[model samples]
Target: MNMTLTENTLVKDIVNELPKSSDVFKRNRIDFCCGGNIPLTEAAALADISLESLINELNEVVEKSDSGEIDWKFWMEKDSEAIIDHVISQYHNPLREELANLSPYVTKVSRVHGGHRPELLKVYELFYEFKKEMLDHAEKEEAIVFPLIKMLDANTVENREEALNAIKELEKEHDHAGSLLKELRIITSDFIPPAEACGTYRLVYKRLEMLEGETFNHVHLENNILFPRFN
Candidate 1:
């Protein structure tokens, strides 16, 4: 709270300076990743939240982290290739694995519970479509977007406009994926399990919650850090 924080500060900069501040932003449903360039005042307005309340929460988190506990900023300072590599290794690969592993559980849960809870059927359908779309999204990034970015980083001669356009397309895909996840959140009531939920039912929700968090961070890296450099 003692620091010179204000409404004009960039959301991404706030997250970079105080890594713990992401929790506050996430809790407030502020977009600190794709829409990170927006100022805090505007972001608060868009989220329909009080600016002062959000700033206070961010300051509190910063204060708590003053004990030298959570000092590591998330992926802000890395080079393009390093950032891309981290994205692939830390998020994309694991997401594919998780999707494959969780698909069965989702189907089983929906089949067993859909008799009473019709929502589970919708959940399974949405998740299946999301998985397929995300797989293709990852492939596009790996095959087309990421390589061009690395080329740009290396100063290699290529079609700059083409690469930029590809990045724009990738941003659109990110938005679509984000929208799908938001629908999933609404359908699952923020991934809360029912009173009659079985073990597999609970596990499906847990893995889904984890996937949502990781997907947010994954998109944050590309939308805020990687793409901006090329744009």
Candidate 2:
């Protein structure tokens, strides 16, 4: 009833209750997995949302949410299927499409301006590797991991051992991919575009920055939320 309760509450506590699904969590930029441990006000500021509004929205969701997000930590203990599905649909598909459109632009710009900016070439090179790796990685999650995680939610322990073994391999790959993403960030210099950057260059930087942030959230969800549950 009291939207105020969600207003100043620590992000970590909220995340432990609301998860990535909570509208309040979404508005305030309270990353439900890795950076979930920040103060509510701080997270709101970082996300450019109103703290009070975020609280109000969350309260509305909670009041209406059939499965009231009373305990985020408890919800996380349930299963990883939902989070995986969200990633595949919301993040993966959109990202793949955006990457396809952006890659050619990056290549063209890099060829022309690379002699002067140089970072364009760096970004172009790293993006190629990142995009290629993610293309396969997303398929693996959809084809294999997603289904297996769903099985964990539905089936009993009869075949859990086999599932766990497969999940372990996926986890290792997740770590490796995480490392590569970190490297890509370094290569892009945090995706900073020069003031004099052309329109296309500016757009690339913006999208790359968004990609980095979204990817960070995605991996954190898998590593902290999904992987632990299944593995």
Candidate 3:
């Protein structure tokens, strides 16, 4: 397959076809997950990147990927159970551990720096809210939504409506989480630490940035790939 990316290509489509394109998007800070429905041109404009440059990079990746120089699996090609298992192990478990470990860093950074950088306080508060919501969301997925999805996938769903409603609710929660992440990015100026930021401050910013990226990818898999299968 000879794939040449154009401005009209959707961000999500690129990621779906060439998963490694996600690394390029991540490097450019382009949202290819929750906000990935837009075209490449629009995404570039939003991120203030040159459309030509973006397209060139993506097309290069596509060529290399097509040449078998990269390992890219289409998640949509996987069975529902396989996809669910991947999400749980690759995203859910790591997210839980990271959130727990990063919580203290957020608190410590905010408490120590809030007096000087009021934004850290907001980061602290938002992180708390996000942590609570994400942990609950993951638990709900494992305990309720995921099981229901499995039933739906296996054609043994007793209450089809219930499964559909659960998926809808989870998507709504994803939107809320995405909004919180956007706010965090804005408040922290794209997670850039201040000039006098100490070791802990820098570390917190880095970890928070990583958290935002991972959450976006997680939501993307569910919102664009997994949930859409049942929808």
Candidate 4:
């Protein structure tokens, strides 16, 4: 059974439990990824949306969603190793490929369109940093952090504090990633392509929008579900 959602519910909790509700938050221009720790009331206020309307929409979608569709809760039932394995296969591997695939389009759009739309220049720079940061973050997770997490799960780690600190750092990195995504949205005007946009230009924006959604779901799993196990 779905819990009664209220204005006081944490944004991440709602997204964590009812994944489809992210659509409602997204449509309302709410940040349900990085800034998801705040309450719906706070998020609604920040987005300048009607709290009642937001709650109603969230409830409607959540009600329409089958309880078995709760991926977040499903993952919660798994062991840390299982969760880590799934994250690697489901998010980490695909993210690396998607970022690489989207790179050329981001560059082409910025190079061709930046003269008239200077914001594309910023988008280019931000995406460059975002890409580099994400790549490095994933490397750290796979090479160092994930192994330690698995060890911690098995009670084989001698340095529990070190593992804990590493998890905290990952959380900080997740916040930075969320900030970069928010800036991308701001500069791209919520990923709405210009009227005169070329095919490649429009494609980049669409991909970036999809990236935002994927990254949100990715981070939501880590920040709210996986990381909390260590905390």
Q: What local lDDT score does residue 36 receive in model 1, on the 0 to 100 scale?
A: 80
Across residues 1-231, which tens digit of lDDT does each residue of candidate 1 receive? 345579999987876565446557767888665678889899999999999998888877667443432212556677889888988887889778778767877898899899999989989988998999999999889998899999988889388898889999999999998998999899999999898776557667766776787788788878987888876
Locate the minimum summed-lDDT window of 10 residues in model 4: 62-71
Per-residue lDDT tens digits for candidate 4, residues 72-154, read 77888988888888888878997897788778768977988899999999999999999999999999999999999998888
Off by over 4 Å in 3: 1-73
Clashing pairs in 2: 16-72, 16-73, 17-72
lDDT of each: 0.81, 0.68, 0.83, 0.83
TM-score of each: 0.68, 0.61, 0.69, 0.70
User: Mind giving the per-residue lDDT tens digits that candidate 2 earns over 1-231?
Assistant: 233454557765653343323334533445643565677678779888887877667676556423432343653765566677678886789668767766866797799789998877777877888888888888888997778778887775468888888778777776776676677668667766677766456556666665776677677677777777654
lDDT of 2: 0.68
Clashing pairs in 1: none
Ranking by lDDT: 4, 3, 1, 2
Error of 1 at 103 (Å): 0.5
Identify the runs in model 1 with alpha carbons over 4 angstroms from their true place: 1-74
Angstrom error at residue 181, model 1 = 0.6
Tens-digit lDDT track for model 3 on 1-231? 466678899987776666556668877989775678999999999999999999988877776442433222588788888888988997899788778767866897888789989999999989999999999999999999999999999999999998999999999999999999999999999988889776557667766776887788788888888888887
Could you report the Cα RMSD, in angstroms, for every candidate shown?
15.1, 11.8, 13.3, 13.6
Model 4, residue pairs in steric clash: none
lDDT score at residue 152, model 4, on the 0-100 scale: 89
Model 1 error, position 27 (Å): 35
Locate the minimum summed-lDDT window of 10 residues in model 1.
64-73
What candidate 2 gets wrong by more than 4 Å, as runs, is 1-79, 156-159
